[model samples]
Target chain A: MKRRTRKAFISLIIAIAAFAILAIELYPIAITVINGFRRDIVILSGQPFKLSQLTLRSYQMVLKNIGFQLGMKNSIIIGLLSTGISVLIGAMASYGIARFRFSWRNGLAYSFLVFRMLPQISLVIALYLMFSYVGIRDTIGGITLAHTSFNVPYVIWLLLPFFTAVDKAYEEAAMVDGCNRYGVFFRIFLPIVAPGLVVAAVFAFLNSWNEFLYALILTGVNAKTAPIAINGLLGGETLTWGQACAAGTLMLVPVFFFTLGMQKFLIRGITAGGVKG
Target chain B: MSSRKPDTDGVSVSLIKGKARHRAPFLFLLPALLVVFAVLIFPIVFSFFVSGFNWPLSEGAGTRKFVGLGNYLALSVDPEFWNSLKLQLGFIFIAIPIELLFGFAAALLLNREFFGARLVRSLLLLPVFFLPILSGMTWRFMLQPRYGPLNALLLKLGAPEITWLGRPVTAYAAIIVQDIWRMWPFMFMLLYAGLTSIPQELNEAAEIDGAGFWLKLRSITIPMLTPTIMTAVLLRIIDALRVFSEVYVMTEGGPGSSTTLFSLYTHRQAFGYQKVGMASAMAIFLLCISIAFALTLVRKNMSLDSLEEKAGGG
Candidate 1:
């Protein structure tokens, strides 16, 4: 009975600590969500407002804002294009590095690792100049290309292990069954690593979706993304904190869902790179 | 023999022999290599060339004059450059340790079986998914002295309303706090995975010997987790060095350049001052620093056989 009580007390302490940490950790998000519905006047007043004062005014404004609409569209377009291209290219390259013996193989793998670590500022500076010279600067194509460059290395690194882990029997069996190498890769290897590919794709999308500095430099009005659009709210003549919050909340919609749904994959993807870094 | 699991070395040799007859691997790698060369390699090479010139955005690309090593020399002597370097190092040194500690604690807390633990874990990752720019904005809203909730709560506690982002020190702290808030989940996730990957039998055996929690953690958990911890810290350090969007959105390295970090400083040099040459030089410098870190990571951890086997085992 005494031991049971001690266990209960310890668990109680742990529960309390978890609650406090969760509250602190989730406070900024909570405020963002709450302020999205509150009136700007109430938000700016810096005082507690009644729950009854909540309204859809901020969401209404954000939805009506043309910049938000355009930015959201461009972000989605860039995210999908970049993710698709990178996943395909990265998967192919990773498979080669995994399955084949070639000179410069390890060298290429290390290059990707190093490339993955290259600062966005460093690469984007050069990209901005190069894109401008090529007359693609500030266009969606330009930004998409830039996103793809960085995403490829990350996708390769993320998917390398998945490719390497497939058993040699699968390939030999496929070969015996009259499957060409490409056929084996396309049909067998892909299906086996489909789950890993999904994780890599999701991460690649997220990186492109939430990307800021590259977008900030490589894009202007036409290719601006949601984050940049929301940031513009701050620089406007009237600071619309409520609307910014609403936009931020909207931007988080995909991330929120992805986080909940892909919890395991997200954790795995994050750790995989670090473990092998 | 065909029914048995083929050894990796034998498979590798067969693949190598097969590779001599077919160009499949090369063909598979060609597109990606081409794209990488065009998009990544070319720009890096171009940047190096441009860094030697007196290139300015205002002066069209055609009219730039060569001033070999000038921009690098300027950066070496620039006080602002040193200040930004100091700030970047400070941010890394200060933020990473706090993040490591808090994240480790959070991981420990959540590592156990508890009701609603899965839901809590999912919720904890919310910050990691937040767009960094929006994170900066959200924190900016919360740190607003006039209208922020934090100051309101402080005032309720009979404390002075702090202009969180108005002053240099507080502004810097505000960014650090925001970073800790945004990043602790990452460390938690990594460490949690590390914690889980630790062999359960080891801990059970230690417990059988009557070791306490701290002792078990010290002896069985931490020593085993050293690689993960090192990897996590180094990854965070590299990321902290590259930080821009959050700081840009929050302080814009403002309150008189106090929060100006490496990336932001490079950005200011390039776009703000239109010093393309100088910014290119700075970028190269940053790249070299990053390469040093990357080399350390690769040299310390990489063994091709181990990497391959680890993947196969998983």
Candidate 2:
């Protein structure tokens, strides 16, 4: 009976610990979501929780702001362009490294990993000077190239295991059946790794969308991203707490859905790529 | 020599059958190498060269004068550069262990079969997807002096309201807290994956011998999880060494220079002062640290075969 009681007490402690961990993890997000719906006056007045003070005014203001709208448009354009280029190039490179034996194979793979580990600041300084000389600074093309530089290496590493795990039988059989090398890669190998391709594409888009330093340095007026736009609200004398929260929530809307739908793939991708840098 | 002959013979036969000496791999790897070379490699090489000059951004390209190691020499004596590097190192030492501890505890707790395990797992990932900029702003809003929710809770509890980001120590503390909040989940996810990958039979064998939780953890769980733990720590340390956005968003390295991290100081030099050459020198320094960490990780973690598997090796 004494032993049984001790076990129960330990189980109770574990339960409480789990509850506290969850609470700490979720509280700031919960608060942000809730405050997004409240009036600015209510939020600033410390009455953010009062039920009657809820309003949609903050959302309206954020949606109607011209600079925020342009920022979102630019973010979408850059995100798609960069993700497309990164995924295509990354898939090819991952396939090459995974399937073939070459003298430079190991050297190439490790260098890409090194590039992925590099701090964006280190690259951004030179990119800033280089882009200005080339006349691509502050353009969508300039920022897209900047995003692709990091994203390609990331996508390659994320997809490496997927390609490596493909069975050799598939490739051999395809070749025997009169499929050319290109046809085998396009038809057989590509289909087998489609799920990983999707995962890599989504993550590449998210990375580009959430990128800040490159956008901050490379673009001035035309290509400011959503993160930069929201950060702009926090500057100067007056703090627009409500609008900032609302804009933040708006930015998170798609990511929230992506998290729920792609939870399995996201877990796999993060483990593979997150450990590198 | 006799055994190696057979292995090489088998590899040569398979290689002959596999591609018939076609240039497929080279063609496949061409585009990516081109892009990576032009975009990343070239800039890095250029940055190294530029660091040897006195190039100011405002003066246009023609005004650059060669100063061969002058900027690096200046950086050697620059107090701010050392201070920023020291602050970043201090941050890595303090923050990473706390994140590892929190993540390890949470992973251990949630490793079993339970009702809300799936839900808890997915929810843990929510914060990881949050934009760092948004994470920074949300914390800034929460820790606002008078009207912030944290202070409101403190007032109700009858504790004195503290200005969280107004002073040097608290400003630095706020940066740490926000970092832990945003990053602890990453550690949790990595450690949790490591926990699940631990062979169940080992634990069962330990239990059968009448070992307790702590003993099993010390002997079985920890030894098996060491590689994951090392990877997580090294990755987090290198990342923290160049942290920019959170500090930029939260404190902007300030009340004073209390929180001027490496990347932020480098950024201030390049943009705020237009000293592109000096900033390039700093960039080169950060690159060296990152490469050192990465090399250690790769050398420690990956075997030679894992790095490159030949047909014979396979």
lDDT of 1 by residue, B1-314 (tens): 01222234444455434643456478878878988898888888988988998888876544688999999999999999999999999899999999999888888888886656777777888888888988898888889886788898898899999998899999999999999999999899888888988889999999999999999989988898888889889888878879999999998999999999999999998888888899999999998898888767765667345567776566
Per-residue lDDT of A14 in model 1: 76
Q: Report the lDDT tens digits of candidate 1 across residue range A1-277.
A: 9998998787777777777778888888888888899998888888744455899999999999999999999999999999999999999988887887665677777787778888888888889988888999999999999999888988888887677777777887778788888888899899999988998999899899889998999899899988889889887778898899898889888887777888767765654454652
Question: Which clashing pairs does model 1 show?
Answer: none
Sort candidate 2 into its docking category. acceptable
Cα shift from native, residue B243, model 2 (Å): 1.3
Off by over 4 Å in 2: A1-13, A271-277, B1-17, B60-63, B303-314
Give the clashing residue pairs of candidate 2, or none. Answer: none
Writing each residue's lDDT as its tens digit, candidate 2 over A16-87 gives 667677877888888788888887777888643565667999899989988789889999999999999999
Worst 10 residues of 1 chain B by lDDT: B1-10
Candidate 1's docking class is medium
Model 2, range B234-253, lDDT digits (tens) per residue? 88877787688878988888
Cα misplacement distance, residue B268 of candidate 1 (Å):
0.5
Chain A TM-score for model 1, please? 0.96
How well does model 2 score by local distance difference test?
Answer: 0.82
